[model samples]
Target: MPSKKEIEEVLKLDAEKRFSYTIKRIADFEFVWAIGDQHGFANYGDDNGNVAFAIWPFEAYAALCCKADFANCKPEAIELDFFQEEYLTDFKDRKMRLAIFPLPTDKGILIDIEEFEQRLQKELDEYY
Candidate 1:
């Protein structure tokens, strides 16, 4: 696990760097984090009304985002296999976008499922 300083530095990175870092981390860890309770997972919306399913590479990152609309949610981990086989397929079927590693101050990177898949694949290739 990353220290507080490392996590803070990652959080301060630009959206593209943050997204790439998250992808690399997730590939290395073989899991991903999301904030949610019994109802459903947390989501983010843009001014244009575009909605995205928010995700993170670490529990600390997801836990830090538990505010505002997601105050009641808790950090939950999804194994990489389930994320790739189930969540990604479902999100793509619903035409949902991804908000990777969103912070309270930053909405993070909003990417469609196909692009996210491609990027994640690239990271996994390098990880192996």
Candidate 2:
């Protein structure tokens, strides 16, 4: 695992580009996830992992939560009201409907890169 400082540095770089980061705890581990607009697509992933591009912010957030332990995640839902109608319409037209509805956001939800890294470091300390 990367040190907290390294993770924070990576997240900072992403944030400098206006991307948001999320930290999720799995079975007994935590992973950093990020989403932001870059090169015409909304990218999502960690420093050295698979990335899902060309997706919406909410979509990326939802996908990350799905792979994590929901009980330990934040408590925010992704209501349609959170997004603009035009964006939804465009996504629908492109056949990229959201698989998870009412995305969650709270303590363990997708947060800023700094927060994500901080929380991740805390979780890692507890785990180890």
Q: Largest lDDT belongs to which candidate? A: 1
lDDT of 1 by residue, 1-128 (tens): 78989987887799889998999999999999999988988778888898899999999999998988888999999999999999999998888899998889998989999998898898889867
Q: How many collisions per candidate?
A: 0, 6
- Highest TM-score, which number? 1
Give the Cα lDDT of each candidate.
0.90, 0.34
RMSD for each of the candidates: 1.1, 15.9
Runs in model 1 deviating more than 4 A are none
lDDT of 2 at 71: 33
TM-score of each: 0.95, 0.25
lDDT of 2 by residue, 4-117 (tens): 574445334432232323222221332223233222323333344433222213333434444343433332223323332444455545534222112223222223333433
Total colliding residue pairs, candidate 1: 0
